[model samples]
Each structure stands twice: as C-alpha cells, then as structure tokens.
Target: MEKQILLQVEGLSISFAQYTKGLRRRNLQVIRDLGLTVRSGEITAVVGSSGSGKSLLAHGILGLLPYNASMSGEILYKGQELTGRLLENVRGREIVLVPQSVSYLDPLMKVGNQVRKGRKTAGALERCRELLARYGLPPDTESRYPFELSGGMIRRVLISTALMEEPELVIADEPTPGLDLTAAKRVMGHFREIADEGTGVLLITHDLELALEVADRIAVFYAGTTLEEMEASAFQREETLLHPYSQALYRAMPQHGFQPLAGTQPYAGDSYEGCVFAPRCPYRGEECSIQEIPYREVRGRKVRCIRPELAEMSGSPGKMDRSPDAENLALTERGRMA
Candidate 1:
C-alpha cells in the first residue's frame, strides 16, 4: 500500500524581530526554505546540532511561535493547509508535541489528572494507567506531582500525556535528552510501535546515531535549513551519503573515526551569500559562495550542495542504492555478476 503523507512542510522560513544596541530593530531569520514530508507509519528524523533551528521547526509546525516571530511557509496536514482555525483546532489534538523539556508538565496537577487532562471517565483512567505502565511508571505515579518524579520519569510522563490522545502526527523534539541509553532506546522503540500503528512521527533530535537506528528517513539540518534528506540506510557508509556535512557527521560517529569537523556553523543573524556550509566544506568552489544554493534532487535524495558528486568520487568503495528497493536489486545484480 502507498503511504499517506500526514504532514508536509514547504519553503518554511521563521524570523524574529528584535531591537539592537542602538534600539534599531532587525529581523533575524532562523529557518529558511526548509522542506520535509512525514508519512504515516514512518519515523522521519530531523538531525542536526543543537542551535540549528530543529526545535524552531517543531514550534513552527505547531503554530506555537511567539508573537514577535514572523513565519512564512506552507504547512499541510492531510493534504489541507494548516492555518488559522485549522491550526488552532489541531494544535494539541491531532498534532501533539513531546517537547524537549519536561518542564511542560504541570507542577500543581497530579500525574494521572495531567495525563488524562482531568478526564474522570473509566476509559480515560484506564488509558492513563496503561500509558504510564507502558513507560515503566508505577501505579502510584498517578498520585504524584511533577516535582516528585525524577527527570526521566517526568519525560516519560510527558510522553504518556501526549499519548493520552490518539494524535495523528507526533512531533517529538529531543525526547530522549534525559533518558538513559536503555530508556532512550525503549522510548524510540515505543515511537516505532506508534508509527507501526499508522501514526506519523516527526522525530526532532540531535542524536544522529539514535535516529539512524529507528527512523526510516533522515533529514540533515544545518544553518537553519535542510542540507540532505535520504533513507537511513544510506548512512551505512560515508560514500553512500551525498552532502559533505553529512559525510562529516558520518565520520564524527564513534564507530567511524570520531573526527570532528573544523569550523563552526554560521550564526543566525550573520549575513553572507552562497551555501551556509561553504566556509567549512572541503569541496566548496568559488561559485558555492557567489549565490544562494538551491536545494535540488541528486541520486534519489534531496541535497542542498552545489557539488554532491564529489562524495561519490572521494574514493570510497561500493555503489549506493537509489532507494531501498534499488538496494535489493543492486545486491542481486552483484550476486549474478559474481
């Protein structure tokens, strides 16, 4: 069966207006021309450094940007544009956010009441129990307040609260920050289970390694925009990856060489032409900094680099599959050739 596109974001730009030293106002754009699609039954992980606007993307999608923040983008949910009344209606119902911080939990409200959102019905009570139990929260957890629970427990409670409603799309922003390895893996596994049940999960995380483990697709965010989006399997080898920054991430992984990339990402307010990554990219040419680089498709993936082919020519062995299906065909062909 063909997968349904649950959420689609196109040309998303978010900027905040602020006063400078002399009280002069300026607009600082954080996210620009960002685009990605989340399909039902799939986990699409957006991985990037902490300050790369990943959280802003989540807030933008949920229509939760502050009053001073100006946003321009087309956010479509179930093929309909999510704006005005539509966004307000589904902000917390259809599309739920598992925020990065557990501080979202109410300090005064009890765990059960908070999870059920004050519903006293038997079904609500039962579901609250099940969700809490599923996350290893004890039965007595319902009676406790947010301050009484551990940080990891509070994180689990936040997840349980989000699951209280059958949300069609789940935007999890750094949901595993305070969780231990086992707990984090378990949480990610639960997300996998949620997606398998036909809910679209947009996982916003800085943990590329963890994202690669469970996400079907991964979108690499950088300098407030997506640099590469491809199948998770494509990250098996650096050569299989397209963008240089993505390759850098692959090398930075512990299993790889743990080699850190030189230079820092450009700040949001700093103005410069060309690719935001040109200053650090090894394959960057003069043209890369002359103009704004357009995101384009290359080898069955979306990449923003001007020279994606250089990764393929970097002397790494083995050919990459165009898609998951193509990977199987390539393997079969290789077997036959042998």
Candidate 2:
C-alpha cells in the first residue's frame, strides 16, 4: 500500500545575490527545480557530498534560509502549502530538525532545560524525560551545560530534544557526522525508535552504506537537483542505478564505513560543465559539454544524467556535483561554505 504523504516539495529554487559593489547585484541560482517528498513511517535518506545542497534543502523546508537567499517553490504538508512565517510556525510542530549543529541544547544552559523548552506541553515534557532516559542519558544531565558533554553525549541530547516533541517528521542532517562508531550506533538507535513509531525521517548524509543499512528509500542529489531515488535494499542486491551521480556515489564510498570507521570522503566538487559530472564521467561524449542532459528510468528510479549507463564508469563518486556549482553557496558564505 502507498504510504500517506507527509511532505511534498515542488520545483523549489533558491538564489543568491552576488555583490559586484559598483554594479547591480546579480542573482546566482543555487538550487534549481529541486523536488522531493517524505511520506509517513518512511526513512528517506538524502545523500550527496558536502555542499550538494542537502542541508540547504532542510533549511528551506523549515523556512530558515538567510535573509539574502530568495526561494520559490511549493512545499506541502498534509496538503497545506508552506512558505514564509507560516512555514516557520509549522516546522517544530509537524517537522523538527536535528541540525548539522546540535540545536537541542543551549551551550550556556542546562541540557534538561533545553529539552523541556522544546516540549511545549505537559505531556511532551513527560515524554522528554522518558526519551532521555530511554536513550540512557540521565534525566539529571539536563542540569549540565553542553560544553561539559562528549560528542556522543551531545548527539544523544540533540536526539532527545528533536524527539522530545514527537513531531511527525524529522530532518536529520548527518546526525552522527563526527561521532565514533559506537556512538553512531546509539544515535541511530534513537532514530530507529522514531521510525518504528511511524515518523517520517529525512536523513541527510554522504554515507551510502549507512543509507543502505537503514533507509527505506534513498534520494541522491547533484548540483542542486535530486538526480535519482530508489529502494536502499536495491543498492545492495544489485547496481541497478539510473543516475550517473548515484552510481558514482556508491562506488566512491568506503563500503565498510557504516559498520566500522574507514576511508576518506571524496572532495565535494572538482571540475565540471553542462552536466557537471562531465569532467569526470568516463562515458562522456562531446555532447556532455554541449548542454545535453540525459535522464532515464530503471525500475522505480528517475535519473538526471545524460548517461545513466556509465554512472559508475562515467564519473568519480563521493562528491557533490562540482560542489556548490551555483553561486548560492549557502545563507551566508561569510565562513566559506565552499
């Protein structure tokens, strides 16, 4: 049976204004015609190298993009369109974020207080206490500040906060990106609990194996577009990929990263044109640079490349499609998002 729809993102585009100082600021398109959806009780993992706009997409859903970045798209939740302040209000109630940064804890305040703060209702507060204990964090630790906890502990606290409200959807961006292997499992366990309860999970990460292990479905992004998506099980049983970008990603990842820490990640971007991966794709014909984009379908997947046949042989894997190929690197490029 088809799962009930929870969130639908359509034709979402984000652009930034380039400062030429003396001249009129130019609009640099960041995300172009991007679209995806999350359904109830499903674990949909969004994978791409850093700067592939994975995080940006999450922020966009929450209506949290920077002041300078402009966005156009229809985001529907329970059939209601999302934009502006309405999106902001709807986020924490129906959708909550486990940010790339731990938003669950106040670095200055006690951990427990933060969780309770996230919980607006008395029942949610009680649930928060239960969840923290369920994850093995002493309800007492809520008394401690973020600086005192270990990286793993921080993850737990954040998960507790995100789930404290028991929102129907979660946007977890690299939930355990920097944790040790043991810590990663614990964190994932918490997420598993949420999924088991029928929450829609949008997991953002570059670890394909991790997705293979846990995700019900996987969506691969490139150069601000959702190149393809498929069942995570299929990635393991066969190579059956329709998008060149997705295939390269599978090849580039250190297959064992999910179970054990291993290997370095490919850089986010290298060189590209037209299809972006044209510079590295082995199957590239001269037309790759001529602006001919290839797209195809295999089983239940949709690919956004000119040559889905050679995605593995066509390009290097494990990187964003030429990093933030567009000018909109992120809300504030002040810190060098690239």
Candidate 3:
C-alpha cells in the first residue's frame, strides 16, 4: 500500500516590490527557490519567527497574494499542475487552508451557511453538521451567525470548514498561536485526527512545541531558505544539524540559551551571496562572507550551508530531544559492539 502524493511545490519563488521611501530599491524577494512536497500522510511543519515569510509561502499556494506580487513556480496537486479555474475547482475539494484567524468567517452568514459553503456539494453540507458534532460543537451552532459563537466555538467551525472537502492535504498556518494552551492543544488534536484519517497535513507554526507535538517531519526555514529538515525526533537531538543558521536558531531558543548570536535578519534587499543567516551566526568567518550559500547533501537532512559540520549535528539534542551525550554514545557504542 502506498500513501498518495498530495501536493508538490518546486522552484517556487515569490517577490513583492517594496517602496517605503527608502534609498531607492526596486523590489524585495520574499521566498526564493523554495521546494516542498506533501505526501498524503505526512504533516510538514514550516516553523520560523514572525516576518520570516511562512504565511507568504502559504498565500503563494492559495493564489491569494496581492496582484502586484509576482510568483513563478510549479504547484502540483495529484499529479496535475495547479492553475486558474482548475485551481478554483479543486481548491476546496483537494486542498484546504485553515487561516490563523477565525474571523475569516463571514459575519453576515449563519455558521451553517459558512460551513456548507465550505464545499459545493450537498454531501459536504450534510457533512458540515457531522464535522461540527465531531468537534463537540452543538449541531445548533451551525444555525447561529459568526458573532453569536464563542471564541472556542468559532475556532472549531473554522477548522471544520477546512475539513469539509475531506481534503487530501491541509495547510495550517499558526492555527493555534493566539489561543490559550487548552485551545491550542485541542486545535492540534484536530490536526492529528485529520492525519490519522489518511489525510496529509502541512502544519505551519512558530511554536516548536506545537510543531513537535503534531508534525512527523520538520522543515526549519531561515530568512527565506530551508536550513535543515529532519524527523520531529531529530529536532531535539544534537546528532548533527548540518547548517550554521539552523544551529544558531537551535541555540537562540530560551530553552537552550547557550550564547549570543546577536544580529538582525538580513534585509530582503541585501546581497546575500552567502547564507542569509551568516551575519547573526557567531561561527561565521571569511569563507562565509564570500561564499554562496551551498546546499550540502546528506542522507535525510538538506543543509543549505557551506561550513556544515555533519558529525556535530547528527546528535545535538534540540530543545525537545535533550539527552546527555554520554548516554547516546553508550547506546551507539553498544549497537556497534553488538
């Protein structure tokens, strides 16, 4: 049995012109040469800080970007190139998005209408009730308008609508960022349930804990490029993260709080021949400043770094996978001795 490939994004690049009375600049490249794949059963969490273009990437896929923006890339859904009307046709059916805000719901419409409108078919409408019920919302909440629903109730509806199509892939962007811990857990639980049903999920969140809790794979994005991608378990392990940028991020977390790698993010217009994170990386040196960001090859991890130290990364405990080095060595030595 094979899990289906739901969506494939290749060479996806997006740019927007920026002019805020700054020293004359033509444009800013937001996301560049970014590639990602979502199989029908995996949840790939795109984690990064604010203004890091996580949401922009999701917007690029949805065709929701501003008209002034330019995007060039391939977005394939179920082996078909996603484009114009066909995109509109399959968007709700094969792909769905749960935005960060529940207010995205139409205030003028009843909750039922909104949910039913989530999908075009009568089957979807009927399933709307089922979805609401599944999330523990009263069936009657469907009859009420958006304003009438509580925050938690509205959140449930927003999630249910995205599930209406029984979509093969769901792109969730910080779906629980503002909610309380309880609400966030419940929301993450919904995604987990969706995944269990054989649907693929690309869960995008800055909350590393949230990503770890729900994601099977993690792709850490810096500036605009992928630094390192590994299994959720590897995120905490110091086994070796082959990129200096990712190492800086790994250290920046308060959980680690190791050293000061202080510097601002590179301006989008800056000439980044080297790694985008080079400036803030304390380990960076002469080679870094001159070299183009090289993509290093590894078994499973993609390291967009030139001075990648594979041995150091293979088992560095991430903020989550904090095991003492001696214990890990003992286990490895035992395996080798066996």
Which one is best on TM-score? 1
Q: Rank the candidates by lDDT, best first.
A: 1, 3, 2
What CA RMSD would you report for each candidate? 8.7, 6.7, 8.2
Which stretches of model 2 miss by more than 4 angstroms? 20-24, 84-89, 118-125, 255-273, 292-298, 309-338
Cα distance off (Å), candidate 2, residue 322: 17
Candidate with better lDDT, 1 vs 3: 1
Highest lDDT model number: 1
Estimate the overall C-alpha local distance difference test score of candidate 1. 0.84
Candidate 1 wrongly placed segments (more than 4 Å) = 315-338
CA-lDDT, candidates in order: 0.84, 0.69, 0.72
Per-residue alpha-carbon lDDT of candidate 3 for residues 1-338, written as tens digits (9 for 90 to 100):
54677787777788987666766657679887676667777788887766678898888888899986899979888888888987898677778988877568888888888888845577876798789999999878977988888777777888888877768889887787667889888888899889888899988787766777888877877666567777777767444555655555555555765432444555455667666766545455688778676545566666676656643644243422323442333322112111
Q: Which of the predicted structures, 2 or 3, would earn the higher TM-score when compared with the native?
A: 3
